[model samples]
Target: MVLLKARVPRAVALLGCFVLISSLLTLTTMAQTTVTSGGIGVHILFQTNKWVTPNIHYKAGTGSWTTSPGVAMSASNNSEYPANDGWFQFDSSTATSLEFVFNDGVGVVWDNNNNANYKVSATGTYSVVSKVSDFKTGDLVRPSDGTGYHILFQPITWAKPYIHFNAGSGWTTVPGNAMSPSTYAGKFSAANGWYEYAISSISTVEITFNDGNGVWDSNLNANYVRTSPGTYAFVNQNTATPTTAPSIQGYVNGPGYSVTSASETAGVLTINLAVNTASISTSYGTDLSALVVTVTKTETDSVRVKIVDKNNKRWEVPKSVFTTGTLGTDSSSTSDAVDALYSFNYTQNPFTFQVVRKSDGYTLFDSSGISLVMKDQYLQVSTTLGSDLSVYGIGESTRDNFKMASGDKQTLWARDQGSATPIVNTYGSHPFYLGINSAGQAHGVLLLNSNGMDVTMDSGHLVYQAIGGVLDFNIVVGPTPAKVVSQYTKLIGRPKLMPYWSYGFHQCRWGYGSVDALRTVVSKYKSNNLPLDVIWSDIDYMKSYHDFTLDPTNFPQAKMAIFMDEIHASGQKFVPIIDPGIPDDNNDYAYTKGLSMDIFIKDTSGKPYLGQVWPGPTVFPDFFHPNAKTYWAEQIQLMYKNYSFDGLWIDMNELANFCPGTTCYDNPPFAINNVNSHDAIYNKGISTRRIG
Candidate 1:
């Protein structure tokens, strides 16, 4: 009976053991590991032009990845490479970077250099800066003779602004937008301001500044002129010979002849031609602004014009209209000119041309429409402010109203001005710019200051500045709008790429100090058979985050390379954060360097702007200054040279305004005091901008 009882107990114990084991197994099966078994992510194809599937599988966190309709993605030297397959964006004015993902599953990074290895983070917009077409010249130079017309060559276009030039002694200092060659800054010297261009778009020009006993004065009448190989429409008669060296002739205005201005600038050419003259016909800046009015003869009857723009690919209008009366006599001889009532056709949008005339107010015929159009539009010194908006049909005056729509037009404002109150018309107006076309391409303008401004497509905008306002902006024109914004298209933009290891995985927390603790984590990765890469050293790594100098206690014998080497061998990297804040302590290396160089971002008090960041209350670097850029670049160079790390992960470099977006702290060391300092380094590659 006792033996039978022992057998029954033994059987019950064995059954209990089986139940516990089964429960444990169930738990393990229910949980996920490095790899999970579940739904696959969105299926996609790479540049290889081959089919790839998660089914080809790699281990991931707690989940297994599998693709439906799985196929092996492959690439070789076989298939033709696709155009702009994949790209990375890294745009900053000074530096713009981009990387391409080829069809071969190969990733190539480019910024300061050509194709290098790179990675992408979350998928988004992308741009390719590689082999991007760039025109020879940039920005327009406004002339003081009268500040309306803007001329350029690349995609030859013309514009008229409230901009005007003034009569002066040396360079025509217009107090506003452009700089006269006489006052032009730098070593452009012989190749300085407003010289008649010798070639298309880009021509070696000269601009000189006269300090005390200057070479050339601002009196356009007295200054030397450079005659180009091109000829005036009427005088040349299509049979004129191309002259190697040409000279501009001065003529006298006669009765009924008026003035456009003393000087007009198109690109670098600045002309100060008077009312009318009887001499060989001559053209000024590439724009019609310099085609000074000279009355060969004036008549009671007026001539009508069917104007057009013949600058770009072809003329945008027709001929016929330009008429003239009989020729008049000059001091030396007689000539033909146009009459007073110069009526122009309203159908054509923008108009520019040269008029030939007879002396003493007699009428002269208008040249063919072929030479009428120019690059950019110019402001005409109208007898009256004719039609509020001349070229474009936008606002004519403060009272003129024009509607704006998201799809059709893009109105951009410069320097958000109104701040709730301050003046009677406290409605400090916003400076707005329009798209180049129905699609907003060809040109883009960002007026960088708070002023009453206007921007138009066919017509143009005007602005008012304070402190005698300096017309400053970042302007770009292209064949298409997409090309202009390939870098940072605020409307729709590309994205940055993640580091390869970053794609695999990243594990982090507040602080990570002590090599042993680091080693233990490394060992865990090895034992678990999981993939891990970065071991971030947060604030703890720095002695109060002063940056550059490391904490000996936290990273002893850092030179041994053992710590970094161990991770590297496993094909991983270490990243440390470097915020733009330098401690207030006088001894801080960064702070001291800034003070020594006069390069700290200053407040309204003309002292450095102070703020609090990760480390402590710190001073921001006045990166807008040239010296500051050099200093900042040096720091980056040191990181690569001294630290021997692969690359950097820049943070807090956006000049981000913390509490108030109204104030992003301005330091006027840039050329036009534009937000981007002349020295600021922009990522040149597409990927850099996106990642940033």
Candidate 2:
């Protein structure tokens, strides 16, 4: 059992247990103490072509077994083993006794010594053979075969198999040299559909195979390492099982809707659409027959086009969550195509609209080629772009470049993955992009829906495929890039002005373990002549990594207050990290108060959802709840009373979760490219269907 202490600011103090364990042991006799030392080594001999690099899965006395496929054994040439026979070696410095098995390292084939396993009670080298009659120890000389390595490849479907290798020298050219079909005797034959490659000048080689293209069969990405010159086979074990591709087809290609009626009120143009029933349905989801399209000129430089079901039964983002500018009322006539800075024109049958700039007559958004698709759980809209157009944003991804490539498909789903993962959704999702045409005119498009989506930019087209919600696009037309950003931020509220001290040099790390350590760090900056304006702390100060609670022993309340005073006297501010997870302890004040206030998110069973974080099991606060702000403010106020911290480092509010398969809602029929279909919907963060 691990006890974690927590305290509310005023008078309440509580003791919590993050985890508990109870074990009962029955012994018949007293245990004996034995001393053990030295190392153990094993030599395995098998047919060379049977396995690539054999793995040794073992457990030393009372220790745990290695993971499946275990550790790879290196090819050995100790002069004591018979030449041409495949030999591999495994060594451990401190394991005196070992119970072990051998595998092909690909997890498919194994040699567990006839299912009994091989055991050793003492240290030193042990030669393992297939049978007792095959055991021998002598200097064996090699037969005068060729002095090179022979590689045999069996491509599952590759039309042109190539070998890329290094022969104790350097690498061959990329994709290397192509191999020809061959019938090598005693090894793989043309009758077995194999391709052969041999390097005669080198006795040892490191090799990988690929098509002339970038696709590779690099031995499951580890490549093949060979030490002896002999016939070997390259078998790809990571080939995907053949199955039907995921259900994302027919989504982009669908029968478009036709405009039945159009009317303009003030600057808002409302168009009623009817589904075209001439073509067959995509069968992805139930297509809403009747839809409403509203085009609101929100600003002189911006316009908001919204598409939704006619009944408005589907979910839409509430105005309280994200506030936008007021709608403009400049247009007076229904036939006025040009409003202020832009014009809206459309084709009525297979309805497609274009937002054209009035100044330069540039088409900012033109959806002419493809039809607009609107389903219950899936919505798609696309616009063509010039070939020389440069696009940026659609971020919350670790992109390789600032400008998006033509083949880039940006998935707009807020995820909890690290920024090091390239081309995947991370943290915040801003479904907005800036496009600069070849002539340098710029415009911005903002998809204001809070749903999972795939924004694909390819083949001179920018497409939006969302799993839910209406297509609430806010287009900002700009004659210049700077004005486009200015108009864009104006619509979505400008960034707040940061404090002046925030611009100054500051220090932050995760390992300032105690209040004294923090003081020492501040002192060191002064001693080293480094100007420090602010200092920050990670979760180390929190009691067992719980939010709003300082560790009593390490970061004592009295000491932390004194340290804060000292830092303030030196004209420095302090900030500490705060995560959203409150330890799910009945005794904990934050958790109890949040529960009473109904602020925590609930599971499918209507109970408070439980997830694992730094503090074992935890409950997340639903920021959408009415009383959530009050509950959160009270906790922060109590914490501030105990320690006078200046600012907070809000973290983990991406609603990150350590628990798996805990979704409270059914997955959408359409899947966005978010690391895979299942993970994108159910395993990323909080479920998209969860109500705040």
Candidate 3:
């Protein structure tokens, strides 16, 4: 039987070339250390190491140097490495004081601050236990004395709100934090509702507001940061205010901006927009300096219109996740107002445009009602919607029965928050949504920008407030929902096929304690004749809940190997969970190697951004790192050789961090604190959840 092959091609295979060379060079310096079947208990098993064939270089105190066991399999091609779960192991059996680090055949690549080595107490300890870490615990400090701070809360629909914050220890609640409602409400401003708090000596503070009831205003992962020192406020401009027939504020009310240049060629219309920037005050930039709108007939039923800054470059998704090429050749059409089964009407100034489906004359998108506000750092795009239109899938969050009702506001921000909550940013971000009109005609729209924003569907309009990035999106016209989905998958890759046995019965949980316990569960399944194809465990199997190490007392290496062998013998598979955060453990092999490879995501200060996770604070791997594939492959090989599991269970992606957005070691760029603002989103919100 042929085993599954990793689809990495030669072009991408070079991602690990440096790792391979470093591994080969390191071998001569260190002998092949071996792991005995004894029960000394491997204390820390580090995952997320980027090095190929990581060897734990250790010297406790001033004692003789030692290396951990070499990986049982080659790291170059870790097909059996169980998907993306890779780990490296280390043991400090005979150390009085532990101060060790990792090397990838190259020189020392120390953790964050100036080659700083992590020190641990190993007196009377067989092996030093380590959890996944982001910073050297001491990096984040809180003061004992208090300092005055202020926050603004213009709530959309909350009553009697209170502020909860961390006062050096855990969460502390204070009542009546919401200030008076704002008086001035318009395109640029909202009423001020302020709250003040005294945060003592803490370097970082996380906060969330609640409405005496169960309802809370925790954007994304529940806690936002208060980074700047002294008194400051975060405004929520789009607060739900009492309005009698209140129209959407950002649309063109009167003769707004004027079109200076207009032309059409090959079924494409180009228009230059001139607007007075002085009118908008709350925007990031002083003015809407240059704007060019382009409408292209990319498909027979589909059309794409892009409004962008003429000279300045905007941020888009780094990877080619969006469909770059036109799905089909542009259809030829002659009518200036209509062409290729579609027609669009627009105003030269206060630029308003509407695209209509030629067949039934149905309006797919219309911006004639509201003014389009395009700021340097902020942009708002809105379109009139049919009353019966139903929308689905502006993702990374949960909704009721996979459908979005009218009057619903959805925030698009990829975060580490858990999935159980309704209306919170969860694990992945996909800025694509399918809208179905009253006649059951389905179409899809994809906003190809990665900036943070809030999308609202009012009674008859869809408003998009992107805080950063260009307003680039595609409209897929499908009379049927299935065709719309087909067009979407063609643009952004399709899902992979799962193995047949994966569909079978599986038993899994977090707290499986020992090998005997796991064995007993397997035995019970057999006794009941239950058709179980796979058995799974969470972080509990690791020593101190670290990624790679199994519990010495509960899950001895010898016993675990035997258990896995027996399970595989019966044609049953075993799977274990792996997370993205690598704890900062100098003594652990994974952290050391990762530091050397420089694969971690950096912060605004150009240092590794540390966020709290299941393993405590941890450094996240930059999946966009050039050597990410090789680093991942090598780690998986290390894990597969150590624990012969059938597959891996990757969790805690969404790069979940317990660190709130405002207090993150590296705050995300262009982050907006106003929760109710049209462009409000928890940018770079680190997600955190307990492993179950």
The alpha-carbon lDDT assigned to residue 184 of candidate 2 equals: 53
Candidate 2 residue pairs in backbone clash: none
CA shift of 454, model 1, Å: 13
Q: For candidate 1, lDDT tens digit of each residue in 407-460?
A: 112122222111111110111223323333443233333322332222322212
State candidate 3's TM-score: 0.59
lDDT for each candidate structure: 0.30, 0.69, 0.56
- In the range 382-414, model 3's lDDT, one tens digit per residue, is 778777778887766545445765655666765
Which candidate, 2 or 3, has the higher TM-score? 2
Candidates 2 and 3, the one with greater lDDT: 2
The Cα error of candidate 2 at residue 297, in Å, is: 1.2
Give residue 157's lDDT in candidate 1 (0 to 100): 10
lDDT of each residue in 201-293, candidate 2, tens digit only: 545577888756467777667777777665666654434321212234434577889999999877679999999988836656767798998
Best by TM-score: 2
Collision count for each candidate, in order: 102, 0, 29
Q: How close is candidate 1 to the true structure, as a TM-score?
A: 0.31
- The regions of model 2 sitting more than 4 angstroms off are 1-224, 228-251, 323-339, 662-666, 676-678, 688-692
Candidate 3: minimum summed lDDT over ten consecutive residues — where? 15-24
